[model samples]
Target: MSGARAIVEALEREKVEYIFGMPGGATLPFYDALWDSKVKHVLVRHEQLGAHMADAYGRVARRAGVCTGTSGPGATNLVTGIATAFADSSPVVAITGQVAKAMTGRNGFQETDVVGVLTPVTKYTVQPLSAAEIPSAIRKGFYIAETGRPGPVLIDIPKDVQQEEVEMTFPESIQIRGYSPNYPVDVQDIERAADMLARAERPVLFGGGGIRIADAASQFTAIAELLMAPVITTLQGKGTFPEDHPLSLGPIGMHGRAEANRIVQECDLLLAVGVRFSDRSTGNFHEFAPEAKIIHVDTDPTEFNKNKLVDLSVLGDANRALTLLYDALLRRLAKRDENNAWLKHVNQVREELKGIPAYRDSYAELSGPKIVKLMRSILPPEAILTTGVGRHQMWCEIHYKVLRPRTWITSTGLGTMGFGLPAAIGAKLAAPNVPVVDFDGDGSFVMTEQALATAVEERIPVVSIIINDRSLGMVEQWQRLMYNRRFVGIRFQNIPDFVKLAQAYGVQGRLVGSLQEFGDALREGIRSDQPSVVEVPVSHEEDVFPFMPPGKGIKDTVYGTSKEMAVF
Candidate 1:
């Protein structure tokens, strides 16, 4: 009846199927207990990877993903991953083993005050003093992390507390003083929101991560079509509605399509669902959609006033609020607005951009758009798309549009590398029936390449498509165009033969030479039903266009890549 065993038993009773993390000194007890537990432990090469895996797992599972770390450095290592979850509203529970209680205030080894440092990132944090409270704290952590606008929660367990024996009974439900996940929606509010949508000359539907979390994709599509409104998404909102849909306007903020941003600016009425007004997606707040009369629906009320002013606020679950609003609109016999003039204007803007960021072919080599298209063709509709940070992630966000909500996962906030592979594994485990693809750059892959061993040992089926160019491609692109091409130390050399390296880890590997070869290679990986790696030989000279220079807003974006390809 040790504390570690009690905690493990509680986790089992709660049916937490997976836990992602690395082992460190203070966390030895939990690791020892993990060995004897039935829950699957995904051993990531780094704590950062562990957090990313948990974040991705949360997105796919529609539940709180769990991760573990040791005291001090171990806990701190997970900061980036946790921050990503926080920014993106990906639910995750981060468990860290702390130094013994007696040494807590004495500056003991590996004694970093994690709860203090992580306050800004986590939805809630608990440092349980008694083993008896461990289960309660865990239950509370999950409830807090997964409810409302989801984010990561932290639980700090002292080494001694972990070893102490106590009766363990995790509560099935929790009640916090200031926390109430289920909110009441007034009928009048829904009426007002409907009126706002119906009275508009030109309306736009702006969706975010919340749309996916609320499982309102169909609702979103229906609302957009019924109201005859244009739809745009934040980065995390890609694929919330099928990109091919006529009403869909790709990602709409900075680095977003020029037309999408313009549409956001011009729309008279904006129905924002399950999304925050992120700076990247809104440009400068002052000039952002000043004309739009916005109806904001979100689980978090605090977010209402954080950005664009809300003309009407509906505080409720996005799915429920949207359903009610849809019904209300229909009940009122509302007539959809004739926004054809606005739509035509937006389409004109889209046509003006030589490359609409759609699947297009112009250059000799495959473009980022082409890469995502080929990948979509290979993977099933339900496959999970994971990515490392940088322009590559943006490319996928712009192009890959197959899956449903929770299907696309990444380290959005921290933009951490070494994240994609480990996260792909977590995703595969959560949705074994679906293919898990990690779209990453060579620099991103190398940051946590050791994850190949985890794939080897666990026999987890995942396909890693490395957009290898052997450079911090994103930064390199920025420096080249904005900083006089003093490439500096951006270039990398002596990289491994990823295919052979996969063999070392007991997994299948292939190096693709061209688009045709890449197509075949991706097909084999998607069909093989086994863990594998595919290295795509992209041009080191290749760069993502439509580049928005660092510090410059979306308006300052390069119309296309070649335009920004500065030669020193």
Candidate 2:
């Protein structure tokens, strides 16, 4: 069979239901093979969106999402999307076409070194030398992408190799020497962590994206409850735990939950699970968890002392580590005293933060949180929400309480704009029965608004809720707070009519001016069963509050007009 045919067969063997990409000259052979294959191809408007779609699919489906693009600019365009996946550890298999093997290093037409270009942004990159190596490369790409710390993997196939005829049989199993993502946790380490938690007066659980990646949400909850600790998730870990639960403090860090920040500050012992403690999350590492003895658990050992040094480091899978910790704690709890006062104090702080004057508005203008709340009421509970990075993303994180794992997807570490629409398309494709909404800012949405055409054409019905403030809200807020409100290049003088833009792409569009209009539009869009855009004109003057000034600790949170709000 031909190499392209073998590639398609390998994708089928992997049970890839959808392959998002666009056809180009170098990839025509692969597209030809796809014509007879059962794997559905979604032709995106741009290669970047194709990659973003695959990233979301991988996150939602808990499998390696596959995306394809041709050589040269086609491959280069996928760089940002692949990097976004890498930053957030989303598993994706990115396949790019290359020049014929014979034309190597000859500056052939549309030739570019895809593997070299993508090496930094991918978990692994391979340029298959021959058609015979295609199957193993593809299998290894998927394996490397989905194992350990999940990340994007790139495979560049030469054009000649695709057309090369070879005797190919899908390998039953493929192995890479000395590559292992999973490791056993030391039983002694688990016992030590359990003992620490058992004796702690104030304990907190810090969860990260790895919890969701490991499918350890239940185990994490068990451990948190076993210790009676307040739980604070990182931005990437927002939906990994039940936010509405009393023990939950939501996300922590800069632009994190006020209660979560407070809990972290006061805790004496922190069980850090699957978290890297990024600088953004721990502003000024010296001041972060000063009083806490952290017991860190992660699959990657490199992450142990890379950020904040912990008293104990258990290197293992999040699920297994958390499960073992829970059991160990149960065994060690006989002499422990109830931390009821700590829980009550944390709950009081949570309530006080909810009532803080900074995060609340007088309902003078349509706010992002209010819009998120209205949309939440209109959309089904099981709907998957994807968001572009900005004030709108913050609002979704703050107001949109995700009830299940994988229901909330966002560009966390990379904080990439224009991630929403494409990701929403992928999420909807991954779970057709579940509704998907892309919460986007006007500035962020415009970056890849072109993806709407793909959504409409492919029949990927996703509702894009554009919080149209006619400005880059997040940057504007930052300038307002940190830079004397000198909004340079932050304000949008000319705003496109998003409804008209959606209509141009054959998508249903609605312009919502008021809260009522927003709700009505959301209901209408959700019922349309078609790709649509609901443009909500939020107030440009409104800012995402409870802001933590740069270089300052979370305790120094500021609100409207740079007024410092005292965090308990």
Best by lDDT: 2
Off by over 4 Å in 2: 334-339, 563-568
How does each model score on lDDT?
0.81, 0.87
The worst-scoring run of ten residues by lDDT in candidate 1 lies at 559-568
* lDDT (10s digit) by residue, model 1, range 282-379: 76776778888988999888889698788888898888888888898887655465456777777777677644433245375655567877788777
182-243, model 2: which lDDT tens digit per residue?
A: 68889999999889998898999998999999999999988776666788998889878888
lDDT of 1: 0.81
Instruction: Show model 1 residue runs off by greater than 4 Å.
Output: 334-341, 348-362, 548-555, 561-568
Least accurate 10 contiguous residues by lDDT in model 2: 559-568
| TM per prediction | 0.93, 0.97
